[model samples]
Target: MPITARQLLQIFPNAGPVAGVFVPALNEAMARFKIEGRLRVASFLAQVGHESGQLRTVVENLNYSAEGLVKTWPNRFSRVSAAAVARKPEQIANIVYASRMGNGPAVTGDGWKYRGRGLIQVTGWVNYQACGSALGLDLLTKPELLEQPGYAALSAAWYWSKHGLNELSDAGHFLDIGSIINTGKTGTAPHGAAERKALYDRALQVLE
Candidate 1:
């Protein structure tokens, strides 16, 4: 069943009017990606809800404080380096995301250009290229397109399906889903895991 705006709002009460705006797009994306059925839809919505901040934050916020940078990517930034780039979204992104995830050096600007965006936080050059190709959009040139309602939901669904999350949902591997979404790896404890599970449990009740 296509999820109703009411159901979405129930899952994300703070979503405000954007909840209705994304309903049709979400429904279409879920249908296209075969993210139907109660289990799949519930799981998909829970993750997307958490990732997007209830359909409000479609773009990744790179503005981090010095401590935040050190904590989030402890391996990447030292106190001195993080303090210099604190609150500098672009600079922080270029430096932290540089030379990884198919990004070029920070000087090349690929990291800032392809910073995480959309519902699923699609980051890096390769992901933009892949999601664009799958959705028939030139995301390399127009990476901000994912911030739009339709593309945000669609790209998120594409990522979910690509990672075989639908099957995981079917098997009730909800924790694995959170781990993959949060840490990009399975079996490890994910950040905000308790919150993700709470969202999932609430979503199941709503969808049921």
Candidate 2:
């Protein structure tokens, strides 16, 4: 009843231009993360499908400059800083300052760098570094590499293995995953609760 590689391929036939390559990598990561249960796998895949638009929009607005960089502070302001860091390095010349999202007037410092990536959409430099360390990758240097299917998949797996999907008890609470990935806000207003429940139901049907 579990979603097999074939079914996943069918579900996301057009998973970006590199579906052929990415799918295998995704499957491998899924297995490595032990995300085999039908419902759990479906839930995780569903989240990825929603976030990355089936891996088509990896760098959120096509901004892949800092694809693998981890954001220590992921506020809206930080997102502005991250954008600045990715663009005008001179503006925030110091790597330490730049890495910290800079104290520049242009940088928002509100924390938006924690957007989406991998299966769980791991966000923030701290998380990126943590995930990278877990997976043996240098996220600090090539944070944008998270856009790459191989690295993205591995990051997601690492997050799941560490956090455990059980933390996401309610299938309807997609924000839980979002929080895990984004680490921005808590579950104030539920978004994907019902839809997630429906998705879980569908997954259960397949399992049955």
Q: What tens-digit string does per-residue lDDT give for candidate 1 at 1-208?
A: 7989999889889999999999999999999999999999989998988888888898889989999999988999999989999999999989988998899999999989999898989999999999999999999999999989999999999999999999999999999998999888998977777877888888889998
After superposition, the stretches of candidate 1 with alpha carbons farther than 4 Å from their true spots are none
Q: Distance from true position, residue 56, model 2, in Å?
A: 1.6
lDDT string for model 2 (1-208, tens) is 2345455545555563566666677777878777766556766766565566665766544223443223432432255556665643333233333344322232543123433456456655677778878888887666677878888877876776687663463354555765554444556533554554454455455545
Task: Please report how far candidate 1 places residue 60 from its true position, in Å.
Answer: 0.9
Q: Which stretches of candidate 2 lie over 4 Å from their true place?
A: 1-5, 13-18, 62-116, 166-208
Clashes of each: 0, 29
Error of model 1, residue 25, in angstroms? 1.0
What residue pairs clash in candidate 1, if any at all?
Answer: none
Error of 1 at 207 (Å): 1.7
State residue 111's C-alpha deviation in candidate 1, in Å: 1.0
